[model samples]
Target: MKTDELDYTLPDELIAQEPTPKRSESRLLVLDRDAGTLTEDVFSGVGKYFESGDCLALNDTRVIRARLKAEKLTGGKLEIFLLRELGLGEWEALVRPSSRTKPGSKVVIGESVNATILEPTQAGRRRVVFEDGDVLSILQSNGEIPLPPYIQRKAKESIDTGRYQTVYARAYGAVAAPTAGLHFTKGLLAELKEKGLSTTTLTLHVGYGTFKPIQVDKIDAHVVDPEDFVFTKESASALNEVRKNGNRVISVGTTSTRVLETQYIDGEYRTGAGLTQCYIYPPYSFHGVDTLITNFHLPKSSLLALVYAFGGTELVREAYAYAVENKFRFYSYGDAMLIL
Candidate 1:
């Protein structure tokens, strides 16, 4: 498919800059694929559409404080965005104003935290080695929340530290949040459980590549960066049981959907952990996900392509038009869509 097929017009104001006051208060857009209908509701009432025996698979990857301020030895300021850990003190990172930050360049982060740039990696990323203390501990004390570029803020606010993350985020490695899971509150999840809906979790550390644009004209030419994921035996057993009992396996986000589809083989869920480069797009058949709950994605993005693949192309186009007409928020901190 041409990349243009996924393009849509969205007003600049509709891009959500901040999260809703309450997590469950965000608007929900329900797309009944079978009925070809679009219905709106509050996210807290999402359980009304689910059957008692249905399974909800959630991504439990936690967003880290990856954005850090650094000062070059020449007194130049730079932003080092940590992507992933490579070794005990080494990491894969993106350094802004990299034009002059060649190999062997050194920068100081905090009073005691310093780093040396090693070499350039794929897609202009750098290999950085820290010199002072534990990398994770240094990030905890000095790094800032890595908000998407669309969210404009003069300074980092305290609210973002919590609101940018999901209520159930546990494993810590992701640079970005599995946004669909952000709408769920602990109270709302408990309510769903009481209603007989079973929930399970897997970890897929959302990568910066999630925001990578589709530069190719043809959608098939584009490649997604591999992200680390883990599907444990317990989660696989629960989902398989749901399928055995003829219950729906509803994926909470595109991240979880990728892991489920990747681990699904021979008509059964398998336990595994590794980097997944699953690039789901239109004209593809789904083997694991019966339903998908996701947030509004950016125009001409791989994420939008996956959504279009799950929901029919024309149906998703109409739904997006409706969302724009009704002024539904867009992007990571935006409202949600449940496609069934």
Candidate 2:
């Protein structure tokens, strides 16, 4: 498929700048693939579409305060966005003003953390080594939440610290949130459980690559960056049991879906932990997920391609067009879609 096939025109105003007042209050667009229909409802009422014994698989990866402000020795201000930890005090980071911060450059982060730029890496990133202290602790005091570039705000408000993350986020490693899970609240999860739905969590540390655009004209030429994921024995057993009983496995987001699909082998879920670059696009056969609950994704993105693969090309195209015409919000802090 051509990457241009996924393109859609979205008004700038419809890109969500802020979250809903309440998490569960966001609108839900239900796409019933079998029926070839689309319906709109409140996210809190999403449980009504599920049958008893259905499994809800969610990503529990927590977003880290990866965006840090720093100043070079020459007094040039720069932003260092932490991508992944390379261990031994070194990290792979995207340093803004990369032209200014060369391999030997030194920058000060707050009062306590000083870092030396080590080397340049692919895609305009830098290798940074921090001077003697816990980097995570330093981030807690001086770092800011790495909001997506589409959210044009001069400064992050207090609400962003909490609202940008899911209620169930636990394992802390992700630079970005598994956004599809953001609409869920504790009350909604409990309500689903009371309806005889079982929920399990796997961790996929969402990387900045999730927002990477498909630069290639042909979709098959695009490659996804590897992201680490953890699917435990307990979670595997729980989801496998759901399939054994003939229940649906509803993936909460693309991140969780990737982990499940990566670990599924020989017609069953397997327990494991590793990095996965499992890119999903149109014409791909899904082996793990029966239903998908996801947020509206950017046009010409790999994320949108995955949704097209799951929901069928023409149906998703119509659904996106309907969403735009109805003035539904878009992107991370936006409304959701349940593809059944």
lDDT of 2 at 138: 81
1-340 per-residue lDDT for model 1 (tens digits): 9999989888899999988999999999999999999999999999999999999999999998999999988789999999988888898999997777979888999886889987899889999999964887898999999999888874356788898889999998999999999999999999999999999999999999999999999999999999999999999999999999999999999999999999999999999998999999998899999999999999999999999999999999999999999999998889999999
What lDDT would each prediction earn against the true structure? 0.93, 0.93
Global lDDT for candidate 2?
Answer: 0.93
RMSD of 2: 1.1
* Cα-based lDDT at residue 9, candidate 1: 88
> Model 2, which residues run further than 4 Å from truth?
155-157
Question: Clashing residue pairs, candidate 1?
Answer: none
Model 1 is weakest, by summed lDDT over 10 consecutive residues, at 149-158
Per-candidate TM-score against the hidden true structure: 0.98, 0.98
